[model samples]
Target: METKVIINEERCKSCSLCVSVCPKNVLRISNRLNPKGYHPAELFNNDECISCGFCYLICPDAAIVEVRRPIKVKS
Candidate 1:
């Protein structure tokens, strides 16, 4: 299984809530500011993400979204 983290850069407030909640430590606050003048959260290393959706759940601004995709079986 694979998970994709989608962040709405403009909506992010750099609250760091998602970054702290993520168990896999996949998210981090970026140094660059977004159009909204906020340092949005970014995915640093998604390989460790378990599709836990903690980032999405913790984001108060609804900026984070997680998509889980099942890996195809090769028989």
Candidate 2:
């Protein structure tokens, strides 16, 4: 089983709040800039996300949105 996370780059403020709040260190700020010219956050590995919701709740700008991906059943 694995988890996934998606980040909205334009909404991110690069405040590093998400980075610090992520106990799993799933979120990180990159040197890469968004179209809006602001540094943004990226997932270390989408599948590595634990869906802890720390990043989403801690974001001051409400930039981080967490989506959980449940493992599919193999019939």
Candidate 3:
């Protein structure tokens, strides 16, 4: 499966809004801190993500760079 969300760690401000808004609960605050001394959000389970873009919309810092919907190929 392809990744649904792309997070820019440098731009993240350790906000939990994304985590709270994620319907699948795939996003989480990493234990590791970024260069700005903030715990950036990371994707824990890409397979579970529904590509709803909730995380992207809720992000105040615009850390989430991309939210992609899976391409369906007709057989």
Candidate 4:
């Protein structure tokens, strides 16, 4: 599955605000550290992501670069 939430690992500061605000718990702090020496946030469950943009809004550093929700089609 394609990731709806795109996070800039290098820009993340290990803040869990995005993780806390995520409704689906799709985002999590990665075990590996980034260039800045902080654990970056990563998309763990692409299928569960709802693309509500809560994570993006809560990220103070704007680590979440993009949020693309699937467009529903009318049947």
Candidate 5:
């Protein structure tokens, strides 16, 4: 299964906490700003995410949630 991190822009504070803890460099600061007018965390390349949960674990804002892609099975 593939994994992806979904960021809640409303809750993020552009703290870059996730950017520091992410070993694979999955997260980055985007030019896009949230409603709060802060540039929050974003995915550089979501397909590379290993679901290490490092970002979620290190996030003080609880802004990131992980979603796993379902695998297909033969009938």
Candidate 6:
């Protein structure tokens, strides 16, 4: 199974809660600022992400979402 992390940049409040709770260290504060003048969180290392949902759960602004793609079954 593969997992993808999607960040709603506009909604992010630049809080590090998501980054700190992420076990995989997949999230980081971006250098660029959002429209709200906040350094939104970004996915830095998606390959290492286990999709534990810690980041999503910890985000206060509902900025992060994890999507788990179904693994393909070979006949």
Q: Which candidate is the best by TM-score?
A: 3
Residue 11 lDDT in model 4?
Answer: 94
- Candidate 1 per-residue lDDT, tens place, 1-75, comes to 234787888899999999898888888999989998999999877677777788888889988855464576899
Q: Model 5: clashing residue pairs? A: none
List residue ranges in candidate 1 displaced over 4 A. 1-3
The order by descending lDDT is: 3, 4, 5, 1, 6, 2
lDDT (Cα, 0-100) at 28 in candidate 3? 94
> Candidate 6 at residue 3, lDDT?
40
lDDT of 1: 0.82
Cα lDDT tens digits, model 3, 1-65, are 76889999999999799999888889999999999999999999999999999998989898999
The local lDDT score (0 to 100) that residue 23 gets in candidate 4 is 82
**1 versus 2: better TM-score goes to:** 1
Question: lDDT per residue, candidate 6, 1-75, as tens digits?
Answer: 344787889999998998888877788899999999999999887778777788888888888865554566899
lDDT: worst 10-residue window of model 6 = 64-73
lDDT of 6: 0.82
Off by over 4 Å in 6: 1-3, 70-72
Candidate 3 overall Cα lDDT vs. reference? 0.93
Clash pairs, candidate 1, are none
Instruction: Score each candidate by Cα lDDT.
Output: 0.82, 0.78, 0.93, 0.90, 0.83, 0.82
Lowest lDDT sum, 10 consecutive residues, model 5, at 63-72
- Model 6: number of clashes? 0
Model 2 Cα displacement at 29 (Å)? 0.7
RMSD of each: 2.2, 2.6, 0.9, 1.4, 2.7, 2.3
Q: Give the C-alpha miss distance for residue 67 in model 3, angstroms.
A: 0.3
